[model samples]
Structure formats: structure tokens, C-alpha cells
Target: MKNRNQSKKPKFIVISEQIISKIISGELLPGEKVPSENELIHNFQVSNTTARKSLQEIESRGYAQRIKGKGTFVLNKTEDHHLVRTLGSIDATRRGFDEGLKVEGFKPKTIVLEKTVLDHGVSAEISGKSYIIEGPVLKVHQLRYADEMLLKDETKYISLKLCPKINMLSTDLSYFKVYEDKYQLKISDIKQNLSAIILPPDDPTNNFEYESALPVFVLDSVVLSRKDAVLELEKSLYRGDKYKFAIIAHPEYNGN
Candidate 1:
């Protein structure tokens, strides 16, 4: 049995997590100044020491650094080999880079390789549920480039029942943006699996025509709507040499 009277997380820890979430979501880009200690104190209703501790935690964790008299600034930790990518829960659903690649001073281009509508009879099993393909299912295949460098290949299967007009929308834009902006749909959750594989030369997915021995990271994902209905299935392949991934876990919380 779980304890009914567990202690809550410390105020400083909670404040640190709030800022970290923004960092992970790319809401706070590298070199941007984080909130000052006074801001944290006022916003979180904590003491000066608590706020200072929170900022210290951020710096110690390598998310930011404090320069005397200039306040703290976000660091581009992704440049380090170990922290190239982060995939986790967030309020916004974004595909490749969070915010935009341009924030990093690179002009990223998203190209639609293919777009088509699939008829019924296509089905897949996820979490023990059989999801049958209904009429006019929208399928999109895309390739992304940053500064003219190949980055990733992505394929998406969107249920027409959820977004019937998806086929009419521009495939060059993010699907989450289209769902929210055009259809006014809110994505509530995501289920994903990550694995690495070396593609054979004859494999159809070797669309980019990479050398046969190159390894890639395959990400399988399902997007869910507010009512827990499946909205989209996505398979994204990322170049392993150019990217790495990290997982950030939050403490398990019990309803009070």
C-alpha cells in the first residue's frame, strides 16, 4: 500500500523543474537569459535562498551558467556528445527540433517526399488495440535538412476520421500545428518506442540513399487526442552519427 501522507517536493526542487521543463521544450534557447532570482522568488513565493538554490541547481545540471553580475544564461549543452537530443513529455507536440532550427542559427528545411491517401484495410495493433484504417487515411513522407545537411526521414499515418481535411493541408508544415491551427484539435498524449538499426542497401526505407552500413535511430510513435483516440502514427528515422537522445523522468506523484 502507498503512504497517504507523503511529503511534498521541496519548493526549490519544484522551481528548478519548472525552469528545466522550459529548457527541454526549447522555450528557453541557448544563450538566452533565465529568470533572475528576484523573478523566481516573486513567481514561486519562495525565500531568496530557495530561489538562489534553484538557479544553482540549474547551473550545476549544465542547463545554464551564472556569470558574475550578468545573471545566468542557457548553455548549448547539445554540442556535447552525450546530450544531443531529448524526447519526453511536453505541453506542445513538436517533430524534429523544438521551437525551430533557426534558433540555432541554421536554416532548416522540411521537404514533403510523398503524400497520398490510403483506402481501408490497413491496420496496426498498438497496446493490445487493433486500429483499422478507415477511408481516405492521410499518409505523409518527409525529409528534413539543416544548413543543407541531411537530418531525418519521417512518415506519418493520420486517421481521416480525426482530421478529414489533413490531405488538403500543406505537408511541409508540422502535423501538430496543422491539427491545432486548422482543425482545432488538442493532442493530449503520445506513446513512443526508440531503437537503433542498420539499414540494408535494398531496404525501401533507405530513401536517402545512405551507405548500407550506417546506423539510424528509429522512433515509433502514436499521437492521441484529448479523448484518448488515436490521431496519428509516426515513424521517424534519425541519423545516429548526428544525433543522440536523453530521457528525463519526473518523480511519481500521488493525488493529494
Candidate 2:
């Protein structure tokens, strides 16, 4: 016979996810911080020990960091933070580099019902089943430069339903950091797509076409979670002359 009282309860991750999502939904703000240990204990109906464990884990993962005098501090706010690109480039991870950001624009445009269509003049690069993920998608575009050299231009689209509150987001705020805390949506894996492109006179930004013969590098990455849902579609283009992407991959064995 089954014990009626012994119900398999949900994990702390589930509770933490709900609370964090509310935070990302702008129910919580940057540098605003979260509840104290005691408040979490009462709110989640969990023990003090369990609540502490949840907060500690989230803080450890760079979603938030504990300060000595102050309580836990959220990391999303852009206060001259040095972050890396994580692409297959050594330059991507270089820290302490002089960087600056320009707020191109941040307005809520009515996203069309369907997905993306690459307007590149050349051949259709991305193949079948890789065009776009299924769901509400919101796109964020930015141009990144390494010091005086124009490095790359990036366009990232995240699930809209999961991030409806982004219209109020600032340059200091980070979407991935917020999602990790709120949805417990870990970035379990990422797949990358790379291609080369030629510059033209009327391209976006349309500046500094080298007199030499060379092409730019375009990268498209899709991030997925353990739940098998698509997190974000990131497409970026880089100046090949200024940056070089270096990676070492080895094949294990042939059919032995």
C-alpha cells in the first residue's frame, strides 16, 4: 500500500525558478537584490538550510555574488563589467581591454508572426531545421568594437514569453544572468554556425571596406537547455582582419 503522506515533493530548483522569473519580469530590479535568508524560508515554505543552499548555489554560478558587508549583489547591472565572448577565439576571452557601448536603440517593435529570413545577398547559408526555434522570439541587436577596431555586430533573439519584460531592460542588465536565476534555465549546451561574407557599399554601418581582398566571418549560434527548449539565437559578424578565431579539436578514433 502507498503511504498517502509520503508525496514526492518538488525540488528547490522549481521554487527558485519561479522566484527568479518574477525578478526577471521586473518584479525585481537591478542592484535591488533579493530576499534575505529568513524571508526566503517563510516564503518558500522550505527550511532555512534548504533556502540557504538554493541562494548559495545561484550566487556561486555568477548569477549573483555575495559581498562581505552587503548582502548578495546581482551581477546584471552594467557597471563597467568585463565579460568575455566565449566564441572559438582567443581574443574573445581577453579581459581588461578598453571597451565602450553605444545604445543604438531599445524600442519594442511588433515582431512578425514567423521566424528569421537571412537577407544576405549570397546563397542561403543556414540549412533545414535550423532557421529558427518555435515560440515567441524577441530580437536584440548591437555592434561591438574592440577599442578603435570594429570587431563584430551581433543580433540575439530570445524567447519572448520567457522575457516579456525586456522592453524596460537597460544596457547594464544581462538577460542570461537574469534567466539563470529566474527560470533556473541553465545554459546546458550551445551549437554554433560559421560562414564568410563579402562587404558591400550599403551594408549596415557601411564603413571601412579594406582595399585588400578579404571576407568577414559570420557566426550563428543556438543555445539550448536541459529541458530541450531553445533559449536564444545569436548571429554575429566579425572583421576577419582584426580578429582571428583559434580552436583545437581532435578526432578520437576511426571505426576500430
Candidate 3:
């Protein structure tokens, strides 16, 4: 009976869960080596395949990372930061990255790297809707730092038709704030898509100074003004090693 019950769940999953529990309980410290496959096989009396899968499972869940030729190690939990941007909300979407970092107790700084006016404008597709931002788009490239740590690299294309002479404004200021305060444009919607990407070493835009290829989160966003007019398009890269994103969800109808 006990054997029959044990067979219901995969042995590798059980082992991985135990390891995860250890991590959650603080038994495994950051940068500490995780158990080797041989150790897991010996300890659990499992086959090599099961042991390998167990480690892979832990790494997939982001609790551990594998270092080539060395072994897997726990990631730093204390420094792992999360950006809590609520989805489908105007106010939350308007909260600037600098403000978010400051709320998290980190001093934030913005550095403008490049700015140019593209007379031909740009094309973008958001939420299955196509947009052709009319000529004379202002492209702003910048880097965001949190407490002296490079956290984000971003490029924003603002429609000059909607925000003329916006390129004259300081790039260090938040575009969202500028759209609302200076232009009096109501930012009604913001659509975002997030995905994991490997930062290529040869990519010119890659500013990370890691010896190995870095993992990053790519955020593509479209900011819309009143009447669903596309105001801006943004492509931002975040350090995957240091940051995570959270979305707040609530029931549509409360059963009060």
C-alpha cells in the first residue's frame, strides 16, 4: 500500500520539493553549493536520471542556479527585488520606475545616453492593433540605476505629433509625468508584454559587465493617451539576476 502511494508522485519532484523547503527554511545560504547529483542519488537511492531532474527542477523554479563545471548554488534572496506594478490600472502604470525604486528604499538615478529625432517615425503593434506613429518621433535612450547598481536600460519613442517639442524637455524626467503635466494629455492606458531574454555579449546595447551571458527581462510597453491615441512605445531591459516583477489581482466582484 505504501509503495503504491509513493508511485503516484514522481520521486524527483519529492526530492526537489525537499530541497526547496530547505532553501525556504534558510538552510541553504546564497552562493552555497547545492548537493551534487551523486550525493542526491546516494541519499535518496534514486537513479541518475531522477537526481538530474531534481536539480533541474530546482533551477527552473529560480531557487538555484547552475554554474558550469562547478555545480548549482543558491541565489541571493536578500537582494532579489520585485517591482509591484499592478496590471490594468492607470495609477499604478503611471508610477515611475524611479519612484518605485525610491519606495523600495533605494536611491535612484537616471542617465540619458542618447537622444535623436527620427523624421520617418516608427511602426508598432500592441494588443493586436497596429499603429504608425507619424513622422518626427523622438527617441530617448537611457539607463536607470538603483543605489549605484545598473538595473535597467530603456529606449522610448515618443510621437512628436502628439507631443511636439518633447525632445526639448530633460530626458531625466519621467515621460509619463511630462505627458500629463506639461502636455495635459490624459494617459488612459498602458499595455505591456514581458519576456525572458539572454543578453548577447556582442549586442551594442548590452551594458552588463558580466563575463558570461546575462539573463534579462524584456519589457515592451505602449502608452496610450485619451481616445486610444498611441503616445509612446518603450523597450526596456531589466537585470534578471536582481529584479522580479509582481502583478496584483483582485476578484471582479467581492462576495460581501
lDDT scores in order: 0.73, 0.52, 0.79
List TM-scores for all candidates, in order.
Answer: 0.65, 0.46, 0.64
- Identify the runs in model 2 with alpha carbons over 4 angstroms from their true place: 1-128, 172-174, 202-214, 248-256
Q: What would the TM-score be for candidate 2 when compared with the true structure? A: 0.46
In TM-score terms, which candidate is top?
1
* Residue-level lDDT tens digits of model 1 in 1-256: 2233222667787788889889889787665568999999899888999999999998888788786776786766565322245564443255335333433335578788889998863555555566555666788888888667667888888989888877987776667877777778888877777889987768976865776667889887777787787788878898777776666677888987
Task: Tell me, by lDDT, which candidate is best.
Answer: 3
Cα lDDT for residue 177, model 1?
76
Estimate the Cα RMSD of every predicted model relative to the unseen true structure: 9.3, 15.6, 14.5
Q: Over the stretch 1-256, how does candidate 2's per-residue lDDT look in tens digits? A: 2334324444455555655675457454333356767888888788888887777865665455565554654445334322223353322211111211221111112212223422221111243445445454555665555334445666677765555555445533455655676667776655666778777645655444455554678887666666756766777777765544444465798889
The list of candidate 3 runs beyond 4 A from truth reads 1-78, 87-89, 249-256
TM-score (C-alpha) between model 3 and the true structure: 0.64
Q: Please give the distance, in angstroms, between residue 27's alpha carbon in candidate 1 and its true position after superposition.
A: 13
Model 1 lDDT, full chain set: 0.73
